[model samples]
Target: MGAKLSGGGGSKFHVEANSEINVTPFVDVMLVLLIIFMVAAPLATVSVEVKLPPAIAKPIANPPKPVYISLQKSGNVYVGNELSSLDTLGDDLKKAIGARNPDEERIFIRCDKGTRYAEFMKVMNKLQDNGFYSVALQGEDDAK
Candidate 1:
């Protein structure tokens, strides 16, 4: 019976199933992707050149300095470099602007970026109380 079973088929040596993962193919695929990215990286950047026309305009002779009211983040108010309080803001602004009519003269206001909305509103209220209706918020233009 043993002789018959041996002659019937299979190999003499025992073969076990392979449990370990094969990573050589995975490593090869990753390396190929890395090389492809390296070759394509330099082509992604683009540069363009532009030429702008010269600006030509006549200069004004002796323009009067505009009245500037500045509000600090610390809640301090200044009218033309002079420190002022909310209670006296109107008086101080009027003094700084001289004989100009408050209603007609444009008042420029510059508030610190971190200043509170309430504090800014208080300053505006003070200006309104003093009959100064013409108000302008000052800001830097980014399109230079």
Candidate 2:
């Protein structure tokens, strides 16, 4: 007549912890972001259309030497190898322009690589204000 076994079924329910992360949602979110960027990438680029004049390759007979305006790294301005100050640049440039047809005159601006953009722009603005529209910027030729 020993102890009576407790009634009922012997089935036991065990609870297990899940440590694995669910990456399905994370992958879905990433794919959505990728698609959004792909759709917007091309729209973000901007382009400008310019109407340029027709080009004619011809050598001029006895072409006039272009006027050179050089800007040094130290912000000094030179008008044709002569050191000129900004205040007097207008008068000097005027005299130079007076010597030739303003319509046919082309002024070339040369600036040292180390020169500040603002300094270079000031020279351009001054020339433009003085009615010098045929201005050209001089750049070093690329070594092939």
Candidate 3:
């Protein structure tokens, strides 16, 4: 068979352009990310060692009982042992605080793990609006 010649008396070869994707660079980037995360995972979590004072070392005479507000997973709000609604929570809290100074009295909020964040915030807002600023969140001890 004789090869076809172009106008300049030289044979020209036509090459088709490759359309396949190159995944080597993508794989290299993924490996780099994996290594970075592996090195950073241990450093991401850090804990502080604390020495707590003995509970029986010092006892105060008639310590005031702290007010407890709990939010359940079912959207139920509790002011101490009494069930309360969101709409009337502010008024109920005001009555609970009574003559005690809001700044001095500590109000602890215990939220269920399954409770919505919005519901927790709503309880906090209600307490803040009612002049209870010394709010604390109560969490279970991790050791247990």
- Which candidate has the highest lDDT of all? 1
lDDT of 3: 0.83
Evaluate all candidate structures by whole-model CA lDDT and list the values in order.
0.86, 0.83, 0.83
lDDT of 3 by residue, 53-95 (tens): 7787666689678889988999999989889999999777767
TM-score of each: 0.55, 0.54, 0.55
* Span of 10 residues, lowest total lDDT, candidate 3: 1-10
| Model 2 misplaced regions, further than 4 Å | 1-61
Clashing pairs in 3: none
Per-residue lDDT tens digits for candidate 2, residues 1-144, read 133245445534433445667788899999999999999999988677788898897876897777889999999999998889888887787676667776668999999999999998899888877777898889998997
Model 3, TM vs. native? 0.55
Candidates arranged by TM-score, highest first: 1, 3, 2
Better of 1 and 2 by TM-score: 1
* Clashes per candidate, residues 3 or more apart or on different chains: 0, 0, 0
